[model samples]
Target: MTAVRVLLADDEHLIRGALAALLALEDDLVVVAEAASGAEALAMARAHRPDVAVLDLQMPGGPDGVKVATSLRDELPSCRTMIVTSHGRPGHLKRALSAGVRGFVPKTVSAQRLAEIIRAVHAGNRYVDPELAADAISAGDSPLTAREAEVLEFAADGAPIAEIAERASLSQGTVRNYLSAAAAKLGAENRHTAVRLARERGWV
Candidate 1:
């Protein structure tokens, strides 16, 4: 039997190693490559031409899993992508679906279930964790504009208005306006409060 060739990428060593081991035990699955970050994932995908790419949602020193998945849609159309994350946020799922990923799974799932989902995704079907899917449906549209969210996201990282402006290529006054608007929309008392509220709602 021809095994399903797979590539796995996650910056967390232990989680990545453990899942790789579990998948290796499957008779019909072959872990053809492994990576520590999204950049490494892309390089290995090009080299191996894996049938499926399993990636962590967040990684260090490179594109996040969503960006990697989006790239793979164009760079390796034959390879399907799956995002596995610890975050239970529904906004991430919405973004992943928009990026052409074939799967959205949580790290909390059992290894056997994850392998099953991978097989389904490789067979040209989409799969999402049931709870996350429901959450996505129930969550209303984000109250913050994309620009406002961008500014508030930096605030969540404790960045000053000047730094946020530099990173986003917006003027300091514009960034401040976005921050203020976001705070008012979220009924927050301050930038920190706005960021916390947005994060709790999974808007960031």
Candidate 2:
């Protein structure tokens, strides 16, 4: 059997080393490349063209893992992609799915399970950590669209409406409307309640 060529991308060297050690145990899996940032990950993927690419969601320098996954999905169909992230935000998972990754798993998972997930994805199976899937399902669909959530997240951070509008390139009126709508959807009494609720639900 041909070993699965794997490309691993993460900002943390320890994490990369640990995962590499674990994956190396399986005779059918081989770590072909290692990268410290999303841009480096992409460059390596293009160069090595691994059979599977594992990416970190929030790399410091360059487009995020989801963006890279989208590019790989479009340009390299035979190379499966997975997102391994520390953040368990439901919105993040939803967005990752939209970007066309084959799997999404939290970093808390056992290394053995990660290897299994990679194999599953290589077999053309979709996998999402059960915990994350449950959170996503119970959290329900995102009540706010991306723009609405963006505005509210800014407002929640105490940014003035005008500043929020300017940053989002939206009119003040539109920003206000989005805030009001988000609050109403969250059953929040006001902007503060909306922010707290969104945070608690991992929707932000």
TM-score for each model: 0.89, 0.89
How well does candidate 1 score on lDDT at residue 155? 79
Computed on alpha carbons, the lDDT of every model, listed in order, comes to 0.92, 0.90
User: Candidate 1 residues 135-204, lDDT tens each?
Assistant: 8788766889989998888878888888999999999999989999999998998899999878866789
The numbered model that scores best in lDDT is 1
Global Cα lDDT for candidate 2? 0.90
The residue ranges of model 1 lying beyond 4 angstroms of the native Cα positions read 160-174
lDDT score, candidate 1, position 5: 97
Give candidate 2 regions above 4 Å deviation.
145-147, 169-171, 199-204
Number of clashes recorded per candidate? 0, 0
lDDT of 1 at 15: 87
Can you list the residue pairs that collide in candidate 2? Answer: none
